[model samples]
Target: MPVLRPLPTQGAGRLADRYGRVATDLRLSLTDRCNLRCTYCMPAEGLDWMPSAQLLSDEEVVRLVRVGVERLGITTVRLTGGEPLLRRNLEGLVAALAGLEPRPVLALTTNGIGLAGRAEGLAAAGLDRINISLDTLEDDTFARLTRRRRLADVLAGVRAARSAGLNPVKINTVLMRGVNDHEAVSLLEWAMAEGVQLRFIEQMPLDAQHAWQRQTMVAAAEIWARLDARHPLVEDPADALARGSAPAELFRVAGTTHTVGIIAAVSKPFCGSCDRVRLTADGQIRTCLFSRSETDLRSALRSGVEDAELAGIWIAAITGKQAGHGIDDPSFLQPDRPMSAIGG
Candidate 1:
């Protein structure tokens, strides 16, 4: 297992891995429960839910965030969920995290069905960024993919998010071959018109049933080809790599202020450049999305592990970090947990 050094002071500095990659961003999953059942993400019916007792309480989550920011130098914290907004007292959690001494950059990723009602409250709670997952522009396609007929609600949440000053709100679209690949540019166009940014992610092998196949993924090259034909894309002039280990490679439309991004996760893995770590809702630490194993932190937390010891466990998870996610390797294995269970 990966092991990390303890904080020098209360909130002193950077934490690096065995390969010298410093982890500065943390993705924290609040719950494994979600309202929608996206075909690519989870099952449609009779999904197994994590027992309430397994989930991190608001206090435990806040304490972990304290250690992350105060000790591990985690400057960014993105709250995720099967659908984060589904978690009650979410604003309270946001407020607690934002109130940390060295306040981290707090953001959220949600399906947006519940956002219209809570965007303002969350922003007021100090959420600086927001990303909404909207796969297709067509209402029918949205229903078919997510098995939820609530696209209008998601769209309204987008408007509410923008109005609430979640500047440059992002829309995450998972591109799939023969499914929504044909609508890549249209999604971009729609985002531009909606006054939000667009990020297209090539589908990966994080589904619940191990149903994913390499041939089924919509490669970033194809999405880029289609988008370039429509809007003429050029690499962002401002340093792309300088933005730390963000997965998206940004692009600018030829003559417009509008921008688009492609997270070529599978076709172009950024594992070598990955600088983020994950803390699952049930309190397991995963070094990478496709990590073969997880270190159980909830057990240690309940066992009365000290803050420094908990922080050490956090660092240990990094020691096992592979150079890459190994999607190209002949022996690569999809994570046993689906995106919903893993944190999306």
Candidate 2:
């Protein structure tokens, strides 16, 4: 594991409160546009795209990231969106982030439509890693899930990413019960063969258009049991940084050295170690992916607040971070914003 140098205590201490968690991983949505509309992520009626004017400028995003790194101990920056690669000049942003002092580890999450063409450029421009969303291996099922008949394109993108040397390229698959659940083992087989780390995610309740039933959720333990029956498994050492921020629990296959991960966010909520913060393309700061609340950072940035002053606003926001999202509550309403709008 790489050692993360402790950030300067002056500005960093301002963000720490009752929760020992300091905002280290910043997920920034570059755009709300996507080429494919997955059934679980967007409304069947389509999405209302945010206006270009409302989106934060690339320079503004860079400035905010600098402040985040300086004051919030943000060391890893993940570029996300309806599909981050959809944004123009994405490489420019990657370059800017790469030039940051201490140079945060920059990564991206994409639907993999445009990545085939841009993967090399992005890697050359300093993107350290990538996570591609792939729901099913069956072409027809993928088409049904994404409402796009371009499964070949997505697969090409994945291969392109691997060729570009994106370390440990992660494939995120949402394990929808009765839908792609039957393909779980096959997906793992494909991942092991391709040298990609496969992550099976429990269907989250954030999809506004989909009627999420708790009964449809495949718990982590159940998935483990099924997978272990075919191939004995062992847990990997717990990753402190990714513990709660990410939903995945990692495991290594007994015979093969390849690893698999399961993200049971709904069945097993890892909220105690949550240390991530999300910034929408429009500049709203979201403390949690399932959060209904947001702080308007666009107004603050446009108001010409200095970095230090803006840092204070971020500190205040982190201080009020909820311990965990109560997704099981009957009152738990899907966020008005979709995953595309929320940056994955």
Candidate 3:
């Protein structure tokens, strides 16, 4: 039997692994398929998707998550996908995770189109929170960004999530300088009124689909400046101290109690505090979002690898994680794989 020991006091920080990095968050991709062709995530003619035979079964994903939580201190698991809702029987997966002795906080990131139909089922299965990707509120712009005219569907989904008790639903907007930057204030205003947390994200070149150009990228500081001019803002006391692993710079409107966030992934890379790992839909474990290397765990699972062997695989993958992603190099070329293929 594994002996229980007292945890050390570490200045409010989480327990770090042998690598001296805290491992508390796991992002598991359920599928490499998305219904929308967002220019930022996939090409107009999307690449061929992974075969069903290769992808990890829901059971496999849950098993891996159990090991990750037990051994790597993962207390939170966020379900992502090409669009997570696209995967069927998601509630089954959610239920399995919820059955844990001390269940981790279950959350999901989605494009929000299908959320309306699934929100109730998801919450009933023990999902705690949700993050919806809404780049623009305008129907035309929304259509342009996602190549789908489903703005109304997404909005309804947000409402459904709230109705289902997914409190403080987060809205993730990628601020493209000339494209959607103009809508920043409006988006926040809507989120504030709706009681949802809005987060403006800086565009990054993680995949080739975005057709990212330097001129189109806006910095987080600029976004803050634009928003601050309209309404006085203050740093959220909860987020004042840099936790090192958090992706968003959190702040709140001066007069309002609601909070908004900004994710500066491109201009300000938060590499030092990255304490999470990603598992693609097909079971390849990626330590970094921008990593080019991945360890194949699908084959191992299919070949009947024991829990000990699987744990060893995870250990090796974590150890191989790079100190930082080299996105600053001018010679840097975007990954050939589309975000959908890699489980964005």
- Provide the RMSD of all predictions against the true structure, rounded to 1 decimal: 3.6, 4.3, 5.4
> Ranking by lDDT, best first?
1, 2, 3
What 10-residue stretch in candidate 1 is worst by lDDT?
1-10
Report the C-alpha lDDT of model 2 over 196-296, residue by residue, as the tens digit: 99988887876757577788788888888878888787875665344556667888888788889988787777777666889999999898898889999
lDDT of 1 by residue, 210-299 (tens): 899988788889889999997899886584746457889899888988889899988887776678889999999988889879999899
lDDT of each: 0.86, 0.84, 0.81
Stretches off by above 4 angstroms in model 3 are: 1-19, 242-244
Q: Clashing residue pairs, candidate 3?
A: none
Alpha carbon deviation, residue 169, candidate 3 (Å): 0.3
- Backbone-clash count (model 2): 0
